[model samples]
Target: MTGEPGGAATDAMQFWDERYVSRRTEHGRIWSGDVNSTVEQQLKGLPPGSALELGSGEGADALWLAAQGWNVTALDISSVALAVGAAEATKEGLSDRIEWVQTDLATWRPSAQYDLVMSAFLHSPVEFPREAVLRRAVSAVAPGGSLLIVGHGGFPPMSEHAHGTDFPSFPSPDDVLASLHLPSGWAVETNALIERTAKWRDEQDVVLVDTVLRVRRDE
Candidate 1:
């Protein structure tokens, strides 16, 4: 029952459930638009089809994808966050385009293939079987489709400084891909390191580094 951002074996879903209960509708650092731009760029030009959005928080990206005509299934362990996300979808009249699921990614099993599989800012708290997970996700993508994985890069300002004394450090793109151990037929369409800086209310720059990777499953 581990949650979206894989961490420990003890109900990952519960971990996020608690976090979301406290924050309600507020977006976490992982929800920044600047970070999502890189993800949008990677998804550009994809046709409307079935999509699975992993760790979907607040439905920001999922709602946008549905607006683009994609049939999106957004999965998250946090009921509170998903509730707010559902409300947003309703507000945007996208409720019909999305199927919200409350599930833990650590134990989630793919029942069918999809045109696109997306995982954004899914930073695991501890070492995980990433390669196995990515490979499984890729396997879930139909041939001639794609898999996109985006997350906070390992190296950045304050990246090593730790978050509030209890947050887990982010993972690098290489670590993710390495965990996947992609097959030979799949080609990496785009791979880039994105550096994003945000101006806080205190005039301090909060640097966020994220990695974007796009892989096309061979037809």
Candidate 2:
């Protein structure tokens, strides 16, 4: 559920919980149980370490990372989503490798630093303090660690989104970099726009532009 739309202007927990719970009765899962393409492309083959994911929908990325020997903290607003991830983790015997945390990112702060901090497609249809939350994650990155943020640059073809007031016009990679306000010790690693095919409404395939940014703090 990296980029899925679940609006919650007042109660994010209830809205997202219902979104996952109701949908699970129809579709087994909202998203494919696989690592995000951006995460796989950017982090594959790197040494396993502590990782934190801000919007860990059903824990696909978390499971994938744990399978690769990385300890992961998967956080989400909905307890239902976390339960799904935890169930899958136990079934796969990866429960010990991952910790599921249910909390709203707006008020929750990381108590410990991670070697990798991820905020993959942390978007919502409702108004959110996204930049402020991202700023909170900056100080949680350990020395020599990296922060990776991926976002939707545009909607898939033939999809409902029109980049209008209705849909969220996701930020660009440059906007993310500017918002971070990292100090001099940080170095930009990869900041580029990538094109990839994505599923629209779980059926149609369309190409989409992805905003990708990865920055590392000096050791």
Candidate 3:
């Protein structure tokens, strides 16, 4: 959701903290106040269960999943972001259904397997151990569980920020799947590029290309 230099010590955490704090000051919330369309659509047929969300900024997806009867643990690097999300969940009477944790995905190891493990738009500005983190995420999926990952396929028109500037090149669906190295009994449900129209600042509409991957671990 926010981007800054990630190479220096504590830079990633500080960068996210500052971004969320500034967003809270300016907009009160950093992202759109709705569940991501890709997530919503992908989870439509799946039954609710224990879910883990990495980089769950503002908890939109986590809150939505909890409302759909899934117990969720949402992790983010920014305390400000998690605080805002927690307050929102409390206000919605869904606080009991979700657990919020603050940790860097690069180093955090999964303590429990989950029925659903997901990360949406988890691109980082600084060089991150993307492959390693994803591999670990895959390992956290319980048998018969699902893993959903959505990422920016490319920048939209009229955007000032270009690829390889704030972040590295967005990984293709195949790239992500290959990095996971999924073992036998894992089935690829969806691995493709899709397009969605996004409203920037709730003003202009920009068509964003997204790489979506969904996999199911066989029972």
Candidate 4:
């Protein structure tokens, strides 16, 4: 597979694809189904609108957003994961509410703006072509819209993470914002690392350090 971000050593798409193909049983859900406590807490009381979920593995958050009255677009590089997400949406009778796209962020172009743009666990162990990914996500946001980014903080220590996994080390929220290199008009709402338990298939009792940010673009 072509490695856009992180280069030849570990092409994320290939690595994830292999993991999907080799899995013997379900990997158990890794994210909470509840409106994503971090995103919800930061966005509480905020009005809803169109949303886009990046690296939307299995679509748990996307499905939840659709239920919340947001028009949602969920994208992922893994067709296996996308298929599973689509099946879940069908089961929930929400197939009509979500637009699922299979595209590689390494080269995919943003088609339109969204009220909220989100990235959850789209971390990579190696340094990614950070500018490309961040710019793409930011460009997808409409003016007056919000951008939310959540990633595992380097807590629970990188040692606790599964070996050989392609997960990325967490950057501080400020660093993430800086990397986005957003145009002059975007306003920062929140940027910090929030500690919380990952209410999913977490087994190691590891505390989840999430780098969370919420930014609003000027109209």
Candidate 5:
């Protein structure tokens, strides 16, 4: 992310909050309200349990988990964005199932563990410790629980609507796994690129590739 007059945390909050406010006014939302296809696919058949979502923008996945009987902690940096998710959960009578927390993931620490600790698209254009934060989240997963990380491998060809293009490079599934430094007791479950349908300007469907990694600790 481009540097602003304020520090990184302040800059992130201001940038994301303002971005959400503008997008909400112009488009009613910044993202599709549906759960990400990869998240929906990977979580199926797993028994519901306590889950923590890093960068839970607008709460689609969090809301879906709650509807499936999992108590969720949805964390985001922008209060404006979290407000939209909270309102939606309330309207759906699922408010009690989710806890929306507005905190910068870069500096925040988890005091309690959860059965599932997952992060989808946790990248930021602005400077933050991406790998370090993800490594930190590993400590929050309970025994036999899973740590799932999903990221955009890249955008469609010649598409100007590309996202997160500011990064130096997109890490592969193996690159992500090596960065985690997983112990022998843990098992790598899923590490591959998954293709799913995504919308371009809400007018047409496009194929999006995701780098997905799922690792579980021994029970």
Candidate 6:
């Protein structure tokens, strides 16, 4: 992945790198070791094929996709995070099933289309053109393929982590859908906010809202 030399772009990269490094040092893993619930629920019963995952932190979703028979290309901006995920994949005997790529999505271009493109919780604190990236992701979808994007709708009422950060505004389902500007033959399979219970600090179950958008390119 490549981008402009300076300004917010550089800051974004450094911010993510530091964040991942800290996570690796403190927690050993940043995200849950399981595939994202939105991904699992959306992909269930669908035929597996080529998949590209953006911001594939810790490779949980990618590993799960590979285990289900989809060849996966997992891309992330953080090498520290990728290394941790790579090690986990190797331990699970899934090393050959995934290609771990270190890339900045701000400028990374897809060389080929995929049957599925997924981005879960791809929020960033730095300045980034997320909509442009999402447009590129949609362009990389082959006909009859699908794109799934899930993001935090808002912080849970009981949250502590997101209390003091300048978290970017979470996009609504309509906001994400409108950004795609999909042409004819494309279908909006899912566009809504869904709530799920999550374990927070192993103390209590917290209800979190997810803004989910799934679109399919018609055959």
**Residue 133, model 1, lDDT:** 61
On residues 130-181, what C-alpha lDDT tens digit does candidate 3 reach at each position?
Answer: 7898899988999999999999898766667753385457789999999999
User: Better model by TM-score, 1 or 2?
Assistant: 2
Q: Of the candidates numbered 2 and 3, which has the greater lDDT value?
A: 3
lDDT of 3 at 106: 78
Ranking the candidates on lDDT from highest down gives: 5, 3, 6, 2, 4, 1
Lowest lDDT 10-mer window, candidate 5? 1-10
Question: What local lDDT does model 4 show for residue 217?
Answer: 94
After superposing candidate 2, which stretches have Cα over 4 Å from the reference? 1-10, 25-27
Estimate, for each residue in 133-211, the C-alpha lDDT of model 5 and write its tens digit.
8888989999989999999888674376465554476799999999998877899899999998777765688888999
Arrange candidates, best TM-score first: 5, 3, 2, 6, 4, 1
Superposed model 3: Cα runs more than 4 Å off: 1-9, 25-27, 163-167
Per-model C-alpha lDDT, please? 0.74, 0.85, 0.86, 0.74, 0.87, 0.85
Candidate number of the best lDDT: 5
TM-score between candidate 4 and the true structure? 0.81
Worst 10 residues of 1 by lDDT: 26-35
lDDT of 6 by residue, 17-89 (tens): 7887676534587666888787788898889999999999888999999999899999988776788889998
Model 6 residue 53 distance off true place after TM-score fit, in angstroms = 0.4
lDDT of 3: 0.86
TM-score of 1: 0.81
**Whole-structure CA lDDT of model 2:** 0.85
What are the RMSDs of all candidates, in order? 4.2, 4.0, 3.6, 4.5, 3.7, 2.6
